[model samples]
Target: MKIAILGTRGIPNYYGGFEQFAEFFSVYLAEKGHDVYCYNSHNHKYQEKTFHGVNLIHKHDPEYKFGTFGQFIYDFNCIMDSRKRNFDIILQLGYTSNSVWFFLMPKKSINIINMDGLEWKRSKYSKPVQQFLKLAEWLAAKSGDYLVSDSLGIKKFLLEKYKKESTYIAYGAYPFNSPNEDILKEYQVEKENFNMIMARFEPENNLDMVLEGVALNSEDKTPILVVGNHNTKYGEYLKNKFKPHENIRFMGGIYNLQHLNNLRYYSKLYFHGHSVGGTNPSLLEAMASQALIAAHNNDFNKGVLKENAFYFSNPTEVKNLLNNSKKSNNLPFIKNNYEAIVNEFNWTKINGDYLQLFEQCMERYKAGKSK
Candidate 1:
């Protein structure tokens, strides 16, 4: 089948979760003899290249920096190009929910959208923008032939909000082959001497609380290394607030997977404080790293980790975990947890689920439920 994937930053997956999802799944589909093409922004420097046996089609969005308007342009062009090329299915991941405009004009094509999260519920956006996003979410679900969600939480939200039933496919992470001794040493992290927390510095992720917790335990033995980009205003604020502290080291956004894996593997414990969203890739990678898991207390994290993880809802709890005499009793649980994630989240199995979803979407389209 000739399939086209639209609405991600780019394919090589240097940035976000959607890009990584597209990159891995597209390659998997291509290997199975399906022709898959992914939309690439010119900013990605993709330049009409082929990656992982899938075609990367580049399109420029001149209004991209304006946020929603830029996304509209990208989505518009992708739909236009897909119609001209006669793709069998057009899958838009985290694009505008109002993209039914594309499917309306196209012939004999399936529209499948991946509802990333409660994007409209995000605290970062203005009230008007949030309301606009809420409308888009409703229209996208109302118009698409099929729907995909990354978590059960999102599935519940969709059902409650829009009364829609979406197929659930949680995001997956690849196995991290343990790195060499010197690799771990480079990060100044011994196997049991430090804890690692890696995530984008956003309000939802609770980087400030984590930093404050680390700062409180100044004399604690376990040094904390926080990895994320400090390039934005929010990021800069956290950097300035914690830059003077000595026990915490804030390493900016890391792009290399190997280096990241090395750091994850050597850590004594993994800290995940994301208060929003469900089943984050970095959290899954930390589980795959065989590190003792400590995460924020919430239904989302608990649903992902069950009894195998620890949780901290506040800075006090985080500080106690550091200052207490407990010797990280979660080792066996962590090992078993690692194995579970390895089996469930391997790119191979996860990609297979995505392929099957696409097939289902096509079957539905043939049944004439394109609305």
Candidate 2:
């Protein structure tokens, strides 16, 4: 099948989860003898001339911030190129691309969109932006021939709000073999000695809560290393507010996979504070790295980890958990949970789920029901 992946920041996964999905899918699909094309931004530093035996199309995005207008440019360029090149299916990842919907009038290709999460509900956006995002999401759901939600929580949201059916397929992380002693020493962390939290510094992710929890549990010697990009205002604020505390270390984003794995492998506990979105890639990578899992206690988290992780809803609960003598970092429960993740979150299996979903959408399109 000729498939095109649309509406992402770009490939090589330098940004976030959607790019990772695109990268994995492109490689996997190419291996399966399917023609895969990924839309990329020319401004990306990792912009490749080619990748993974799959075709790469660079969409020139003039805007730097990459909001609504940026999406318009990307979609317009991608859709125009796709029309000339032709494709069996077009898979979209972001909602701001209403141009794809407008072009759907004439052609009836299989349009499957992987709706990552509810961008409207994120704490970063203002009221007007949120409302606009909500409208964009609705249009995206209605436009797609098939909707794919990364988490069951998101699928439930779509069903409740739009009364529309969506396929649930969570993002998967690249697995790393065991790290060496030298690698661990490089990160200045011993195995099971420091807690790690890797995520974008956003309000919805509750970065402040994690900092507060660390502050409250300051008596403990176990340091919490927060790894992320601190370039944004929110990130700068978080770094400023939390850096004063000795228990927390704000290590800026580490791009190297081996170095990242060095941190993930040596950490005693993985703290996921994201209250929004699906199963985060970093959290999945931490689980895959055999790290003990502790996340913000919420139904979305519970749904993803399925009672296999320690949960803390508030700073008090988090501090209490840290103080508890019974909560050993390398407990059997944690080990077993990591084992389960190693078995479950493999990229091969996760990508296969997407392949199947695309096939289903193609079949539907062939049956002339895509509209």
Candidate 3:
């Protein structure tokens, strides 16, 4: 199959979850003898023409200059290039900016869109932008040849909202086997001696709420580490608000996978505050690292963690969890989460699932053409 993956900044995962998915899935597809192409932003750090066996196509992305609006231009460029490729499958990772060009998609290609999450529900966007996003979601659902959902919750959503049946294919993660305890010394923390949360500082993510929980539980004196870039306006505000809590340490954006894995493995309790996404990569990584998780109380997180994680709905719940954390036996939760990664959420299985879905789509397409 000739497949082109778009909607991410690029492969080799310089950015977020979808980029990570692109990097792994593209390489896997390439290794399986399918001609796979991953589109990259012209400004992406990795300027190479190929990664592993996967082909890389670089297009101009002016997000640096025009901010969020630049994404629309980038998606347009990618779609324009994709029309020339004559791909068998065009795997769009998200539809936030790309749905507008659905009309321009290659005629010969079967477009399979990964309906990411309830993106319109994000608190970051204004009312108009959110409404626009909802329209885009509908457009992508109507336009795509098939839809893929990363979680069962999202699949149910598509079914209820658009009467569309979407294939549920969650993101993947590998189990963390290498644990270097010495790395903790650099951060002035000991193994399981501190709590931690790693997420983009966003309102919807409930980063502030998580911090507030820590602040409310301040008397317990359990040190908590806040990881991710604190350079954003919201991030800075969080820093200033939480600075008075001496137990809370804000570690800026960390790019190293090994370091992140190590941190997750060593942390006493890992808080996952992402409230909107479906099968977020970070949540899987935390589970893989055997981190004791306290995720946001939502269908998305609950669907992934099930009864295997500690669920928190608000700052009060977070406070209560931290206060009694030591009394909780984390072994069963750790065991269950690790098994999930190994058995279900591993990259090999996920890549195979994609292959199976693509083959099914191809068969259906062929049947339609024969008719």
Candidate 4:
């Protein structure tokens, strides 16, 4: 099968979850003898023509120069380039920027879109922007040949809201048992002596609430490390607000996978505050690292963690959980999460599922054409 993956910064995973997905999925598909092509931005540092067995195609991305509006132009360029490729299938990772150009997609290819988390519901966007996102969602739903939901919660949402059925396929993660204690020394933190929160410092992620909870429960001598791109306005506000509590350390964006895994594995507790998104990569990674989690109470997290995690709704609940820290006693819960990752979120299984889905879509497309 000739497949083209779009809607990400590209393969080496310099960016976030989508890029990581593209990297692993593209490589997996290529290994399975599928001709997989991944689209990269012009500004991405990697200049390679191919990664692993997957082909790489670079397109002009103006986001660096034109800001938010540039994303649409970038997606447009990708779609335009894709029209000439004659791919059998085009996998769009998200529709936020490209849904408007669905009409431009090649008629010869089957377009299967992964309708990522509810972008219109995110608190960061203004009302008008949210409305526009809603329209984009509708356009993608109408234009695509198939839809994939990363979580069951999201699958139900599309069914109920858009009257559209979507395939449920969660993200994947590898378990991390080996931890380098030496890595902790570089950050001046000891193993299991600190708690951690790793996420984008955004409003929808509930970073402010998590910080409040950590600050409120500062009686413990253990430090709380916050890792992300905390250079934004909200990040500065959280820093100033929580600076009085010396126990909370704002460790800005550590992209090194090994280092990040070590931090998560050795943490006394890991907080996952994402209220949106389906099967978040960070949450899965934390579980794989055997970190005792305190996730924001939401359907998305509950669907993944089930009875295997400590849930908190508000800052007070988070603080209370910290004050009465009995995470060690919940060894079974931690083990359950790890088992879930191995059983349900394995990368090998996910890649196979994607391949099967593509085949199914192709069969259906052929059947429709014959009719």
TM-score of 4: 0.97
Clashing pairs in 1: 97-140
Collision pairs in model 4: none
State, as a TM-score between 0 and 1, how close model 3 is to the true structure. 0.97
Q: How many residue pairs clash in each candidate?
A: 1, 0, 0, 0
Report the candidate with higher lDDT, 2 versus 4.
4
In order of appearance, the predictions have TM-scores of 0.91, 0.91, 0.97, 0.97
User: Per-model C-alpha lDDT, please?
Assistant: 0.77, 0.77, 0.91, 0.91
CA RMSD per model (angstroms): 2.7, 2.7, 1.4, 1.4
Two-way TM-score contest, 2 vs 3, winner = 3
Angstrom error at residue 156, model 1: 1.4
Ranking by lDDT: 3, 4, 1, 2
Model 3 lDDT per residue over 138-205, tens place: 99999998999999999999999999999999899989989999988888898888999998888988
Query: Which candidate number has the best lDDT?
Result: 3
Tell me the spans in candidate 4 whose CA falls farther than 4 Å from its real position: none
Residues 1-371, model 1: lDDT tens digits: 89888878779886688898888888888999999899887788566589989998888765557765776776677677777888898787874533546445366677788887777667778899888777778778887667887777878877888888988888887766667668766777776688778887778887788778888887775678889887889988887898778768877877888887777777776788887775678888887777677788987777778798778988888887666523256667777777877887677777888889887767766676645
* lDDT for position 276 in model 2: 82
